[model samples]
Target: MKNLINYTVVLLLLVFSGCSEDLESVKYDDINPSIFPSSEADVQAIVASAYYPLRGSYGNGIHSTSENGLMFILDATTEILQGPYGVQQEASLHSYKASSTSFTRFYDVFYNKISNMTLSIDRIEKSNVNEQIKKKAIAEVRCARGLLAYELFDLYGPIVVAPLEVLKNPLDEQPLARLSNAEMVSFIENDLKAAAAELKSPAETPYGRFSNGLARMVLIRLYLHEKRWAEVEEQATAIMDMNYYGLEENYAGLWDITAPVSSKEVIWAVPADYAGTSENQWQLMVLPNNFPGRGGYGTIQSSWKFYDSFESTDIRKMALIAEFTGTDGVTYNRANPANYMQLGPIPLKIHPDAARTTALTTVDMIIYRYADVLLSRAEALVNKTGTPTQAAIDLVNIVRRRAKISEIELVNYATLAKFNEMILLERSHEYWCENGQYRSDLIRHGKFTEHAIDLNGAASQSEPYKALFPFSLAKISEGKGKFIQNQGYN
Candidate 1:
């Protein structure tokens, strides 16, 4: 399977490298509509091409400025992560300019991936493959497209939902218009619902591929973001009912390089390795600069406030490294508050495994996990009922017990607002570096701007419009005034 993935990548590169000026022009080459994807293997290879974009590769033309890809862009803007002076700093400080390279790279790369998926779906539908296989494959591709669209919507608000019909017609030069937020949510939900119906359960599919659980997970997230409490509860409950996934017995082991397949907690993840073939670039971002061979750039560090939030007995604190024993057996503690810039507590969640060198750890990038599903269910239940219930408390307790924290009782949270606060805090600790969820979680809780002001010491005046990132100046120019700059940016 690994060999097949590698082969498909090489085949795509060769085919794409021979194309004309644009990706659409590649359709006229030897790999044209008339000659492409004649068999199931060919269709599968095209689907594999869709997966590459999730890693932030958009073929020859689009390039990501951040080494860690889209994940860095998503995370760097949040309060939990502190970075050295550059794009990461710019993001954390909320000082994003229209010309920022990070914004342009993310905007271009994501849309490019969406276009690639649209083309792949078109080719798959037109192929001579078995009907069942074609339907399933298309469902998978649509789900991938929906996920990408959701990320774009989360960052930039409404965006053009480019389908195959729109992308394939090069001669039709009409301006693309952004969907309303409600319309966009409906669009993504429709795709995910179709996908969930066709996808195999997590236990039945290959470890890294999307599954019924993953599709539902995405829906649950979408509903949560929309504050559709009942739908979030329904989707989360459905995933829990599958009984195929659960929390890993050891919290820290979930991030171990060698335990990718063994960790039952992970619902969906990108297959990756330390080798150049499908590498996990995050390993190179979080490690401290002084570590042995393959020392990381130390681009991101955990804030002292984030570190201090964890209870002393909570085993999840293991994810943060406050001190380390050096190769020479010398002990080193985290830097003092005044010197945190030079040395701060490292996010050791994706650190090197004990059995492997820092440069060779193959920790897969996890997307959805069971613990998140449980928390989402709990939050949804509380919000739906307008108060906490026994079921909700029990669900929260389940995750808390696994983290070795004391379970909360009904009396602990006097109001629904208090319980919701607890859930948001738990999410922050559990999912700190796991794909930049903190930003959305903050927004969902209505505390994004407030928290940013407190954390970054920004202006006390609330600027709710800043919650949505501005469309890159380059993207707006490309749209020829069709794209409206997000409010407050202009």
Candidate 2:
């Protein structure tokens, strides 16, 4: 939160100094409290603004996926994989993101985005904004805002239970008023419900705004986190009930560059134009050398442990990597798939367009999907009942089956603990780098700290909390300390 306060100031300065040229094209100033959405074109522009921030994310368009990366660390602790996150020599993870400039930059990015949202809301509320358009924009903003707050909670602990417009202090020495797990879940649920109610139906937005499907996805997430088994099942089942979403017929093709347009598997996606849009540059995860058809610096390389986790029958193992050495064109050293995922096995979750051609091809990323919904339900069911029923088994097996391990027969009740482990395993494999949201899953399973590598390179010594970031020091200085930081770290 301190970082956000600081960044908010910097962002305000930037906004004051010069505005996004893109906004100029939209006649942004025309979007006033007194006169917005007077016409269809204006409404469309407001809808377009909804897609902002997501693609134009901060840090020079580099998304650290602090949530995703942190989750990777958590998964590593569970023997999920030894080195996928920071196992490499250069995966610069810091003890306190508050200490890192990158973390600060992301914090600022969030506020800048919220600022834009505020503007949108102000314009719509003050002007003759299109009713339909206003509904869409408001729903999208609330959903996006809720998502950001939820994400912050995922990172820092939920010590501060106030809204985003307000700020908190990390340095405050007083005992914190943190939200309990159930309370935190309630917060997320209320926001999602508001979004779900006000947002358009699925047919209202063909991925244009926050739709019923998206709300269902968020609800499923909330229910899963709250350990509300029946609710999780209902939400997941609701999504599956929709005709617009499901697992793509081809599992490997699900990540194909054209898959976003080709399949409905994607529940939420960050659409891209590659040239016209913010670069889908995450290829840096495994963009090796010349012989490769893709482009990226290959930073978040795969680990040998991750590779070894795949059963021999798992086709996802093969889909996740390419082993052939392009000796004639480029060379990459052979790295172990498990502990030594040294950029050896690239993330197959997203494939770049071979043509590098049109805007439509470099589709936006998928943030939510049907598979995740099922896995979340599987988690909830297992948590509620020690033994996973056939339905739970089917949920787990269906994903594995899609990965070409069709004969996977669910077995063993060994213990409730063992079953939870299995649910997490399903998440690790099914989600992995796909959604960049797996870290929360690890935290929820209480495995995040068990596997965390602190500054001393030892597992964390503190009790695991919500992992929410504390208020930025800047916020505290600005008198935003109605809130407080989590227990351990400031």
The prediction achieving the highest lDDT against the true structure is 1
Across 20-97, the per-residue lDDT of candidate 1 in tens digits comes to: 111221112236566678987777667656555664232322212133355566666665776767767766677766
**Which whole-number lDDT from 0 to 100 does residue 386 have in model 1?**
88
Q: Pick the candidate with the highest TM-score.
A: 1
Cα miss at 192, model 2 (Å)? 1.9
lDDT of each: 0.70, 0.53
Which runs of model 1 end up more than 4 angstroms from their true locations? 1-30, 56-68, 292-294, 325-343, 354-360, 458-462
Model 1 scores a C-alpha lDDT of: 0.70
- Give me the overall lDDT of model 2: 0.53
Per-model TM-score on C-alpha atoms? 0.88, 0.76
Give model 1 RMSD, 1 decimal. Answer: 6.0
**Residue by residue across 1-490, what tens digits does model 2's lDDT show?**
3333332111211110112322223435422333445765555456455455554332332223322233333333333323334432222232443343333334434544544554455555555645776666667666765665565555554434433234333344332245676676676677677887787656545542457678778777666555678888787777777666667767667667653543567666555444434434445444444325544444455554466667787766765564634424534445433332453465545665645543223434556778897777777776776666667777887777787765434567446777777777667777776444656676677766554443215433324542444455654444345545445546
- Residue 97's lDDT within candidate 1 is 60
C-alpha lDDT (0 to 100) for residue 269 of candidate 1: 73
